[model samples]
Target chain A: MSETPIAAPDPPPGLSELFLAFASMSLAGFGGVLPWARRAVVEQRKWLTAEQFNEAFSFSQLLPGPNIVNFSVIFGSRLRGPAGAAVALAGLLGPPLVIVTIFAMLYTRYGDIPWLQGVLSGLAAAAAGLIIATTAKMAKPLFEKALATRSLDAAPLVALAVFFAIGILRWPLPYVLAVAAPVSIALAWFRR
Target chain B: MKGDGDILLTLAGHFALLSLFAIGGANAAVPEMHRVAVELRHWMTDRQFADLFAIAQVSPGPNVIIVTLIGYQAAGLAGALVATLAMCGPTCVFAFYMGRTWERFREARWRNAIQSGLVPISIGLIAASALILALAADRNWVAGAVTFATAAFGYWTRLNPLWMFTAAGLIGLAGYI
Candidate 1:
């Protein structure tokens, strides 16, 4: 993947620039911010290669907390240090927090009307559907790996087991993860 | 009723704990959030929880803003600030440290194995989250149909999701759902 180097390189952004970049990304991101973040960091700023961005994002996704928030922290820390990380996080979340708080106030004031409730319900249904679509897209890589190998992979099985245990059975999360994470890791280690 | 300080502290503490388990993102913690908000604390009803999630989904920025909404509902603006800070703070520190060290382990076998293992589990958690949200949101046959259609559209087409969200909201406003 790294066989061919790009022809030109851009200077890495300073901390203030990083803050502005993430703040704008968050501001423009109406439904999801990850796509906007990728565009800004990889495409516009050229801070990281596309491959590097994917790696950082995947690593961030594997960690706790929100994915984009984690990405902001990781990317900022890579550029500078704790201060940069804090700056990036504040950039990404500060504006959204204010906007969402305003929304909360509006909803509380007018949420009791029947028509607004109906709209919210409809929006909720569509939002649920979007989540399902996102899940399928996220799982596609595992399914493709299993297909290419022409063998039933343990990863998909482990995933299904987790789905059934929590999604179907309604088990508490910590207990399920306590068992599933280690088992999945062991299986991968053996397979490797 | 609890004091403002007490409410803010509790909000901060609970979200900080949940932050650790947010494997695939804050969405992965929805069911647990539901349990805590609706069942345990009586902060809101199931419908209110679902509606707040929808608001977060439709709003700009990250979907985790639902935590902010929950905090707002529980203890006003102070609760919101505390919840968001708690949710993002500890995990951001972890990510910062890990990012610094991650390149050092670029070729490490154990790192690769751990990454591969966590991918599927993260996908599973997201699926569970989708299921929980779907159950909460799909209240009627029309709502169910809207959800199914939206999923199909999202999967099959590269169209912007905002269109679907707008369409659904309009449908609801028109009393279709």
Candidate 2:
């Protein structure tokens, strides 16, 4: 949608600005950085529009490893080559490593306390809910797109097959994916 | 017991492979991580694995931090460093090259097809991860209720998730859940 012919108002960000932006987002990201990253990149900095953000994020998701980390690298690389990618990655991961280490130390020392254990259990339950919600949010758009496009009937089928294999049957991931991914891709290619 | 170096090497090798397979993001690999860490290797109990995942979620930065914490549990600071690098390093290089190609082929029909096919699979994997996590975390009716309630709120509202976590934590601190 943002593939506009008009010129952008601002120039691209410098390496320092990119680093600081990622660092701030990392600190602010409590549950997941995807939302925070969206705000910082699309709204605050105007580095990418909403459409561009979605494109980059979707592409990042398609690659292996952490989606946001991959997004950081690709976005930074796009902006300033390898150096930008390095700086942005450092900003994203550096602070949290230190903070999490401190938390690890504290948990190790006092983790056996009954009340603390209760708290951790509660947090785990909530985290489960959060993931479900994230899945729902992600699915809504895809389903809508599928219906509108008059294709993607196989998409939901593939999704259900994967869910059954991994979630219910407890099959190994690589094997199920090895079979499922190719079939899904070929289906899409033929349908398209 | 394995030596410290052996443990670190195992962690490095396992996470490197996991990184490549984490197509839907780090959360997609949660079940495998749980299987390896708790069931296969016995690095820690199921409870500890759940707790570390929760801690990573509550803390800032990417969800990938869970790998770092798991590595630390298995070994030490050195383990954390090695695991984090192994998990992220190859992926970074892959993304660097793939992203460049993707931009070049922004309008390629094949790229569109691949993306469409993969999106649903990623969604399915994430749902599986959620199911496993719920099974691990919900030890009682109250905890299960908390999971249901949080899912409702998260889906219906735009409230920051930290608030929900805080409410649940307060419930726990009160010895309720």
Candidate 3:
């Protein structure tokens, strides 16, 4: 979504560093990768600055895939070229892929077991908590910036309102989106 | 009766259509996934679907990997492979190939307008999905409390998420097998 500023390309980070950085982030990823990803790429490794991260993130958001997976490809490509992108993709996905594959296998074998099913129920609730928590943590900066600009404006507020009305209130989602989406965007245009 | 292959084909058609509508991510299409899994195919019971989702939730990678696991159970190895590739392949190709070209459209008035419009749509979908997940997965007061408390804690506090998971683990220990 950003217009490119004219400048020479930044030098690529080394392969080893890319691998190590992704590994660090992956291991630390608790509720989700966003927190660890923020710590690793922006705070610790200095692979990309905050401005660059946001630009890549916008593109990631625009893409029709998981944002974190897209971030792996975009950030890795920027930091290490095609090979770096490949490495980042593999590193980021490798653990989960392997683990899921194994779990899928075991699940196919043992999933009908009643005890296993009971355990998964509790775990699933926990997963919901995890997802909500992670989204909350990521939302802080957006919330802070909105308050700082003294713009308790409609856009972000509407996004949250739309979310609450649909999520908590159980409004039909398509109707909620149809009504709220344009209004939220218009709020942004006005703020600009 | 339709051959097993035909059932797989039917599931594939469902996923393919769902794939196109997945604007936000793998996570975005989940409510539809639940609809199909529960209402359409009858491949699983509701509790089973909720459990599959939970396992997917705790795992790394994309949230949709559970689709594969569910598919495998319903149809076998081919089902797993078909569901995995079908769920992810279209979106990945769209991103990897057309991503840069998309950025060029950023300057267009309607393009900007579309994004502005899309933001709320996506948010709505996400919230709906989260709520569906909560309803389907949360079976008890303990589970409900964990979800609410965790969400509030995550939103308002700076607690390490790992610690939260640890707390959940303790809760799980009390109730889970």
Candidate 4:
């Protein structure tokens, strides 16, 4: 796995750029923001390679709290330390907070209208689709790796167990993780 | 009724605790949040909570901002501020420190295993999130069709999804769903 390191072609983005980029993505992110985050960081800005983006995002998910919020903080910290983390977090949060509040105010006033309800219902369904798409995109790389190796790995099996426990049985997260996390990690450790 | 300050303090405390437990992100904590806000504290009715959930999902930014909406419902603007900070603050700091450590040990063997091991679990949880959202949002067959079509389009194409969202909303506005 060792390869000679090469310098990045472009310099890392500055703090302000980080802020603006996060802010723009946050606003543009309807339904879910992770896909937008991946798009901006990996495809558009080239801040991180696709693999790096997946690792960072996976780390964020492993940690407590919201995955994207943690992702923003971690990414900012990686590039520019604490202040960068602060700015990215602020950027990710500030604009949407204001806009959502405005929507909240409006909701209280016209919440009962059929048209508004209808629009929201449609949007919600589409939002679900967006997440499904995101899940598929995330899974593709793992499946590809499994196929290339043609080795039986714990990944797909563990993933199925998790989906069944949480999605179908609706188990509380902590209990399911108590079993799945350890078993998965052990399987990975031995295999590695 | 509890005093305003008491309510704010309570919201802050509860969300702060929830923040640490929200593994796999905010959607993972939806059931807990529902129990706390609607059943325990009685801040809002079930209908209001469901409406706010819809609003949060439809808005921009992280879906976790549902905390902001819940806070606004219970208190006001200040409530929104308090709840959001409470939910994000500790986790942000934790991520800050953890990110540094993770980078420092990027080449470590165990770290790589941990990283690879966690990916599938994260994917599974996200799939669950998608399934739950589909169940909740797709009340009618038209809406379900929209969900299916949107997923297929999003998966196969690289187009900006905002267009689909706009079209879906318009369909709703037109009384189709």
Candidate No. with top DockQ: 2
Model 1 Cα lDDT, one tens digit per residue, A1-192: 222222123455677998999999998887779899989988998877898788788788878889999999888766666777888998999899999999899888998899999999899999999989989888888999999999999999988988888788878777888899899989989994
Docking class of 2: medium
Worst 10 residues of 4 chain A by lDDT: A1-10
The parts of candidate 1 lying over 4 Å away from their true place are: A1-12, A144-150, B1-3
Best by lDDT: 2
**Residue lDDT tens for model 4, A1-192:** 122121122566788999999999998898678889989888998888888787788778778899899999988877777887888999999999999999888987887799998887777777778878978988898777888999876798788788788778777666777788778877888884
State how far residue A92 of model 3 sits from its true place (Å). 3.2
Q: Worst ten-residue run, lDDT, model 3 chain B?
A: B91-100
Over the stretch B1-177, how does candidate 2's per-residue lDDT look in tens digits? 559989988999888888888878898888778877887789888888888999999999899999888888888788888889889988999999887766656788888888778878888898888998999888889999999999999999988888999998887777776
Error of 1 at A26 (Å): 0.8
lDDT for A27 (candidate 2): 91
- Reference-based TM-score, model 2: 0.92
Is 2 or 4 the stronger prediction by DockQ?
2
Query: What lDDT would each prediction earn against the true structure?
Result: 0.85, 0.86, 0.66, 0.81
**Candidate 3, true inter-chain contacts retained:** 0.38
Ranking by DockQ: 2, 1, 4, 3
DockQ, every prediction: 0.69, 0.70, 0.40, 0.58
- Every model's TM-score: 0.93, 0.92, 0.75, 0.80
lDDT of 3 by residue, A1-192 (tens): 334411113566677767777766765564357767877777876666677667667777766556776777767765555777678766776666567767878876787776665566657676676566645544455567778889664556765776677556655434555567567656656655
Better of 1 and 3 by DockQ: 1
TM-score of chain A of each: 0.86, 0.83, 0.64, 0.70
In model 1, the clashing pairs are: none
